[model samples]
Target: MEEDIAEIPHYKYYFATFKELEDKVDQIELLSDVIGVVTIVQDLEKSTLNSRITSCRNVTIKNVENKELQVTLWGHKTDLFDDNVLKTLEGPVVTIFTSVLVKKSLGKPRLSSTTSTLFFVNPNIPKVEDLKTRFQEDVKTIKFLPSAITTQSSLNEEKKENRKTLVKLLEIRPKSTKDMRFTVKAVIVDICEKDGWYYMACPNCMPPVSQADVSWWCQKDSFINKSPLAWYKLNTIISNQTGKMRMMIYGRVAEYLIKEPCIQLVTNHVNQDKRKFPQAIIDVIGKYKIFQIAFETKAIDNVAICKKVFDDETSEATNNRHRLSPPINPKTPDPKVSVNQR
Candidate 1:
């Protein structure tokens, strides 16, 4: 019985990363044709809309070539096996069911001891390679693919263009100051956002200010009767093999992208209307059509670079600085006492 089980043909496996998997995915025979061991497990509790109904455990598996494949596990298997199976099982295989694509994509994979689709543990599996040459060649092919942006620009120049929209995330870095305005452009690996505003500072003195009651204060004067205004500052950092550069953009140009009404809300006190605060910020930030998707990049998208003003505002050190003076002489401590007592 054991020998017959070992002879049975299981799902064919593909050894590739998620990117590679996406590329050659069409060549895959069927959803049922793919299988591999779970290599990584992700917790999806925080982000999803239906947090209650779904299991948080999602698995990522590495095939023979060390390519990662994300799998969602669900049903009875959620209760049967703990996450420790990933560490303990030398080989845990899963069989794919093509007809089950709808639900399979929704939940993580479940393991069953008897089912061919599920392998509790199997010792026999191939070693993963460092890199797949075939994947590298395919990437090279994609690199030469024609861009629609290029085509659109040519058509516009010839006056033969129709109404068409192009959506792209462009990173702009200040190359140099021209006519008192900074010139910038998109560069690879440099962070960029489409429609976000930087905390506005005064152009004359470049001072940052919080919302004042029904007014805004500059260094010497208060601009009263002015609708609460938040200045949008375009923040960008450009880095390449040569070096890195940081730029802060201001004036009417920044106002055009961020808009006036949204900026007013950021600078105003909306305490009584607490719900509007978060949504207002999101609306202002989201207007930037091209956003760097990664969280790390997004965090610094609209940051303001300003100088610290006062010495008292400095951060204090936690370590003790005082040192006691040592005794003048080892035997001279008996000034107040008798020589016999010493």
Candidate 2:
């Protein structure tokens, strides 16, 4: 059996540029093998199918030629780049994904990993190093930052455009979006983990960043920055009357949900215990909220898009809309402010 396994032919991978994938979107007739660096990692999709939960992540990769490609991975493959796991890559890296189907969804071209798809991350290969070098230079020129959610006005406009009708959390089913987004109403049940609710990200690309010997480094962007910027990235388990699942709230929405800017939160928790979360952030365990979602082809789940938190009280505090916005441009962290990069 061991010899038989070793005898199986390794599939050949053809490094591709996003330009080669443009016309191939929206149809499975053209399958591809592509390589690039992780620029953005969107939230996991909230769904369980085939008796197991499959989560999806929306990723943007910069190819060797400096072209960007959107790749979606569903199911267990999403774990390949989890916050802690990808750090093992130890520095900047690139991904080589094979046998993915290209399709267009939500106005963007999407490449999804199929059952036969296999992905190699930060592999020890010469071509991968070249790709990493190219990715590093690309980050220097591009604003590789956290993804921004649709603003209230834009979301309202999309609704006016009549994209899709709202649905309950329990009503979500496999293969529902047909490459469209979803909107649902739910309530917060509990926080998943409070310790790392906010992460220090590279000021360039906002992937969970870490400290290196001389400067901070971003694994996804494949480069090192002078300092790190703290960003709000939360994963909480929420529910409707019928069902519950984990969802992600990021950047601006996270500030709105937590009611605290990430800059302050990180300042307060720098030397604190890792197991405890601030009571302020913990107080929203029972609030009702509305959300918009996009399909995660990898997890076969959906990522929460637009969010509006509702409170029971009729007070002015309850009526205030979220005022925080992601910076129009990435800002360098103040040199005086201490960043806990462990």
In order, candidate lDDTs are 0.34, 0.61
Give the winner by lDDT.
2
Model 1, span 212-252: residue lDDT tens: 77656666434533332345454545333244444343533
Worst 10 residues of 1 by lDDT: 306-315
Cα lDDT, model 1, residue 184: 20
lDDT of 2 by residue, 1-342 (tens): 676664443556776567767655533335788887776656665333221235666777776666677877778777764744554444355778888987767766679887777888777777878766765645532223443443445534433332333345334563554565555555666666754567776654467776677777677766664456667666777666466776777665677677777778877775555346776676666566555555444555644444433323333352243222345976888887778741
Scored against the true structure, residue 287 in model 1 reaches a CA lDDT of 18
Minimum summed lDDT over a 10-residue window in model 2 is located at: 315-324
* Model 2 spans with C-alpha error above 4 angstroms: 1-179, 300-342
lDDT of 2: 0.61
Give the TM-score comparing model 1 with the true structure, all chains together.
0.24
Output the number of the TM-score-best candidate. Answer: 2
What are the TM-scores, per candidate, against the unseen true structure? 0.24, 0.41
